[model samples]
Target chain A: MSSEVRRIRYSPPWGDASIIGVAGSSGSGKTSLALAIVASLNLPWVVIMSMDSFYKPLNAEQSAIAFRNEYDFDSPEAIDFDILVDRLRDIKQGRVAEIPIYSFEKHNRIEKTTSIYSPHVLILEGIFALHDQRVLDLLDLKIFAEADADLCLSRRLVRDVKERGRDIEGCIKQWFGYVKPNFYKYVSPQREIADVIIPRGIENTVAISMVSGQIQKTLAHKSAQHQEQLQRLGKIAEDAPLSPNAIILPQTNQVKGIHTLLMDPKTSTEEYIFYFDRLVTLLVEKAVDFLPSHPEQVITPAGNVYMGLKTSVGTSAVVILRGGSAFETGLRRTIPDCRTGRILIQTNYRTGEPELHYRALPKNIAEDGLVLLLDPQMSSGGAALMAVRVLVDHGVPEDRIVFVTYLAGPVGVNRVLSVFPEVRVVVARMGDDMEERWVESRYLGC
Target chain B: MTDNTAPSQSVGPEYLPIGRKPTATVSTNLAHDNVTILPQTSQLIALLTMIRDKNTGRADFIFHSNRIIRLLVEEGLNHLPVVEHTITTPVGRTYSGVKFEGKICGVSIMRAGESMEQALRECCRSVRIGKILIQRDEETSKPKLYYDKLPEDIAERWVLLLDPMLATGGSALMAVEVLKSRGVPEDHILFLNLIASPEGAKNFAERFPKVRVVTAFVDMGLDEKNYIVPGLGDFGDRFYTM
Candidate 1:
């Protein structure tokens, strides 16, 4: 029934990743400036992406000059802005992106690429960060790190001769010939468009706080929007009948008996655990009926051949951590060797919005015949939608996935089904949408 | 095998059967080669007394009986085999240890046996459980298989055979036969129960020496009606219905 219900389009908080571009002359403390901003924000999702990693691989002729420190590394032409812009666009939309690892010593791009996913804010630090028009379009905040010209030259001299294995002459030669000229022609012009300019870079606390405050405000705005979106979706799902995709266990005497024990206030902890786990087993068992099977035959001890649809294959599970951990026993009981993965989505206590904290999925999950998303309780279905979005982004087909939970509200189930109409949900019981999650705390004993 | 000459195995690495799977609130009494009865400790006896009383309600019977059932299941896991394992500690020194190493499933005799399913699932997570229903032939007074549903890979897993009361060894014996016919080795099955008649324990042990038996209590013997003397009445009726 949820399929015919109004659907709400959703994008995770990470989907609209904010981009901050930091540009400066070589040795002008741009790296320090970005780090200071990160320290002020005090967030894990804020990432610092170096523009040096996107440097164009030099030809043999240019490489020889670079070896002599005679090549122009400071010029915007040397930075591969195309790949940089593509990576920025990917982060802006919360897609997994591979960043090239360029080797300065070898003057070539390494074969390996570091993967980045779900970054909420990226600090693109390089001389050309604000130089490219495509990159400028993606920037949410622009910062130009400034330092004295003589100071920058001296810092470059100390940095190169001591750390980069360059001689004093080569350092000075590159500083005057390439770095000095590039700052005037290409780098200085970016300062005109910068939202904030930091003089003395990391030492300028006033500027750092101002920039961090603006970013924090932006995050608060996004979080408020996310919570509003969830409430809107919940309202749409409030009265809709459960979709056929939600396969609750047949309410037989056995299932009802377990439910009574679970709901009773006087049930002992041991019995509560036993019956809950038993109920979980039955729920997962019902979930198997949703899995596709092929006909196969087995010979009984009586030497008679009987055809069976399937013994189970190619099925894996993704546990939405903590609450989902409660489903492990039930999952293990049903599929003893079933491969498992984990995704941690926690609610913001103040904002009432769910945030994706961490995720580690099994290899080639998209290829699995079926994937079960396990969580013991659902009220708002905010986390469910995000969890489903995570799986969909990872290449698992929506139709091949199932969200399994022990207790859920109609609105939560309807909301998830409305967005992912193809994906089914298996819940043991329907309870109040406002009911708090106590099953996991009781089961985990924490 | 009943003497636990074989080591215990778990899902992780397994070395030697360091000791029997710990029985937190119960201790071993008989220690026979194939049978283990919970010793009459003050703790064990008190729990037994509550369930044995005829006036005891279903709620108390279930609560007390489950305590012993948990112990029986742990004792059942004790008979599996284990392999030697070594690991490096955080202090950067090697520590020789052992871990469990095998898959396990439960087979519950339907009706009464079904009561023990939760306990099995409690001790073992996501444990695949099969159901077997047996009824006595009124004329022959013999156990007969009425229905059964089991895991497809039963032959390869360590089986925990669950039945609350063992009397006359009739149902337990027939249950083992059903498992063995399905290719599960006699040694791989561990019969777990809350109470047993001495006659029942003896008959079961003599029949299947390889299948280990773990019970919480062993009463004196069976009466003419085949009911265990001083035993809790019709366990299924008391536990399921009021």
Candidate 2:
């Protein structure tokens, strides 16, 4: 085994920096050094993406070369720079991406993929993360971890022989013929472009500490920016009209009866279900009022029925499950033909905060269709707000989302309205006052 | 053939185990081996460092414990079968890598276990999540199930049961029992925590050796009141600021 290198520890975990890239020659201890930095930072949102994850599939010509050991896998031409740029962009925007998993034993790509979700700190570590201009554009900090060519070769020799199932003679031959020359020609030339370069790779404790401190300072700055956005959301009033397209349902006495049953602390579970379903039916009916209507007539047994209203656009009800799912039963009762989609959003009871659990919506939801965002209750409105945000991000128009809740307190209604003014709020009842925590009694009951 | 006591002659420095692939391909599999299971005392030190400091507010306490719990779970998962895989990129490219052994799910004990969700999310993205809320029955002091939502494919996945503090292990036991009823294999279950009492660990060890316990700290004896001594107060209360 190659002698163990000294471990360098970075102070203060990697802060909320957008991009941090690691670059080095073929066997320069880049992986080991990058891992040390990631471990020391201990940032949960950090994603260590490898440039090897972007290797180009072999063509007939390249496959023949690979078989003959004639292909230069270390060359920059070996990677897919477009996809690398795309993945980096997705990471920066805090979205999800399907990262490729590679295999060298068979010299082909594998079937299984890893889903990398929103990372707060993105650690792009690979040979070409810094070499390619397109890839480097996405990096906020560029680090080049360099080691002695002979030392790296020895580590590679041990690693290949013991771990990779390679023969000693073949490993040495490949290291000398292809790997070393590629490093000098393609990888080493990019060193001058790096913001920071370290000798002895991870063995340099001083370098690692300096990098860690810089990461912490960057993260502290980001946390402040996030706080500011949340503060702005706090200032926006809950009940304000979200947008001109908002379709507020008219309150009626039958609705009041349902609300009474829902709001009463003395209500039994049976009574709660009954009123909840009744309100759901009413909310579904009111949501239908927002869709485009076409002229139609109903036939009666005794005589021809007069012309009446019918929906023009196909309607789809997407329930944010389990609470919103309860509304599905009522939606079916009102419109038996309506298609249903489920999005699970659960509340962290302690923080009273909501998180997206699961979501499976229709592919064409954004294509001129009416979507009912049904929830049994909305309090603090975070889940409902996020649910709407998800749909919006997925291309569903804000006006297309009609939020129908059985009951909503002032706080939740205000939250949804403020975040998405164009979203319609239809409910059996809306409470006036919010508790100290901003949750209404009716919402709490649900 | 080499003598029995001799360092082998066949395994040389360049003895590649399989093919002409680079050593970097296999280096990743052994990266996390430096894992050390901190003793119960060390865990207490780590926890007390966070909770005892006047600077450690309710938010920071919950945050740091969550961080510690995530590491514990990741360490446990390291022992799983993560075979090397290859995948095609969206641009029709190929990449080689290693992935988790199987599908994973989280079953949290209501209240306390729920606080650990953010950390779990940070660790595994797009993980199919489930919940089992069982509170101690005030009258009987036995666990009473209030709510549960698990994926249909939960039986096929390894389940991680999360609870911040395990004192008597009653709630955790009940949760495991419930998951088994749902068809989760006993061996497929891993119980994770920020701190655990010996009584709970012993209870778990005796009841199901098949189930692994991944905890940051296994504290000394439980208090007369059944609280983990040097515990970070009532986890749920502290988490919710009650």
Candidate 3:
């Protein structure tokens, strides 16, 4: 959510930003090690997420107990793990996440939130950083800072007294009764889960440098792979071949008339909307014919048996936001009973890759007889590909998905077909010229 | 009525031969009028292609099969009884609508039938479900009922019997018998399948004239081994990797 955090505009199918989790007992220098790694790596984009920020807000009774130093902060129950897992997933998907700020003095979460954008590297540091299995699975690397119990206790004693305004006796009593016991019971066991254990915490310069070096190497390799993938995608778009699975509408006079109206630069927005609706309606009508039907025997008004075609099953439509939304009216006009679903996909201005922002599909979409994926235009096919991926992930068959778009460039169409060969692509027009306008728009930053 | 005598054959579970080449041709006498073969739409054809392709992975096979099954279920729902109801629209106009009349229950013929359970549940939230496991004896290929579990009020509900394939109609006939024994009227039952052969469809209709048959495709006649020709191999093996 922080505008300062660089938004990764591009996402290769294979590479993702690395996440390193640093876990240790309190005062074991977990935060220090996290800071050193970010500084040593010299990465332009890095984020340090302190697990303390995820503490569950305490109620009046709990706050009173915490004020009296009777509450155990180190317990795993003290954290809002559900929110932590959600934030971790959001970050992994290259989305901004709002992290809560905890007030140790009040023993509750403060009103404000820190907006964090996806970072090149994320370091999660806290006592339970490696505690939850779901959180552990998301971590690319886990480091447990190990220090002598006596040393940890001594450090906690000094820090709490100086910074937290705690008396020497209260700090010592809490350390032994609450902190030390929880450290052994909960924190120390996580050492087994760590990929690397650093002894003496940040003072161990050798261990710190080694960990930072490994991160640097991984980042370099991933970025290189990402660059190669981008090149491959560009090449695929350049050598765009007509996919055998694509259905291109014939350039009939009626179709041509609408195309001219849409293509004309001087056309009014109202006229464009009208023609676009007509064009989409025509496309959707044709696409519905592709849905299964059965022969039905009906008694006609003349008292004769009539054989007619009846739709076999229910159909659903999922429209990509904005451009794809233009086809919703057409879809309804064609199949009034069809349920509609919406998916919002936006191109990260910086990454130039489509990122899913919101999705609200009808319940039982998985059981829909057929799904029509609507996107009005396709130049790079990034959004279409992402939309198809979402559908497939939701258990919709690749073949059951029919992508209905008004205009499709060979590059985008081929890119989609290459990954999902069985998916049916229906377009009003498919030609080399489709990319021209898109390219000009990109150049103008439109 | 056809002869009710059961074939005398017993075979172990592991010895059950699936996708076996037929050794002797069997005659089929199904009434085509009682069966409905859905028209092959482009989307249906594409889905079938993915399902029939030998190289399709298990995950993909199941995914496509589920989609096809949902369509089949929707088609079956059209036959259910409905009553007209009136409602006021947002524009302040009264609109007459139809709603399903009776309670619905899904009775799956395990284990291939289990694949369609998710689709049926998605269609109707309050629908009850039952299961019947009827495995074929390896030697006779006759369906033998081993387990049957039905809801208490199944007699009053419209039952949708789910099975992915109708190769010989032996299991389907047996499933219908099981439902009939539970007091469910033959007219109240709808048999849904992904694919069925002409011979299998004929056998099922002959056995239960009142039970409706809905399937995606009616393939060519069954072979000597009773497997539907141009069939997509053994559905259970492909779907469950058994």
* Residue A33 in candidate 3, Cα distance off native in Å: 12
Q: Residue-wise lDDT of candidate 1 within B156-182, one digit each (tens)?
A: 998999999888888889999999999
Who wins the TM-score comparison? Answer: 1
Residue A344: error of model 1 in Å?
Answer: 2.3
- Report the C-alpha displacement of residue A147, candidate 2, in angstroms: 4.5
Per-model TM-score of chain A alone?
Answer: 0.90, 0.71, 0.60
Query: Per-residue CA lDDT of candidate 2, range A114-174, in tens?
Result: 7665466778888877887877887889998888888888888898778767677777777
**Candidate 1: Cα lDDT at A424:** 84
Candidate 3 colliding pairs: A1-A116, A2-A115, A9-A350, A9-A351, A10-A351, B22-B225, B30-B202
Per-residue lDDT, model 3, residue A388, is 81
DockQ of each: 0.02, 0.01, 0.02
After superposition, the stretches of candidate 3 with alpha carbons farther than 4 Å from their true spots are A1-17, A25-126, A131-138, A143-179, A185-227, A233-241, A293-313, A336-340, A348-352, A355-360, A433-446, B1-242
Q: How many steric clashes does model 1 contain? A: 17
Ranked candidates (TM-score, high to low): 1, 2, 3
DockQ of 2: 0.01
Candidate 1 residue runs with Cα over 4 Å from true position: A1-6, A58-65, A157-170, A294-313, B1-242
TM-score of each: 0.64, 0.51, 0.44
Candidate 3, residues A1-446, lDDT tens digits: the string is 11222222335332255789999999898988889888887754577899989999999998888888888777999899999999888777655567999887787888988866536578999999999999998999999998888888888888888887788988887888888889879999999989999988778889989998998787666656654554466566567557666888755544555555565444456666665766676677557655654433343222222223344577899988866767776676446567889988776567565556667777667777679998877877777877887677567877678899887778788777666776778899764423533311211224
Q: Weakest 10 consecutive residues, lDDT, candidate 1 chain A?
A: A300-309
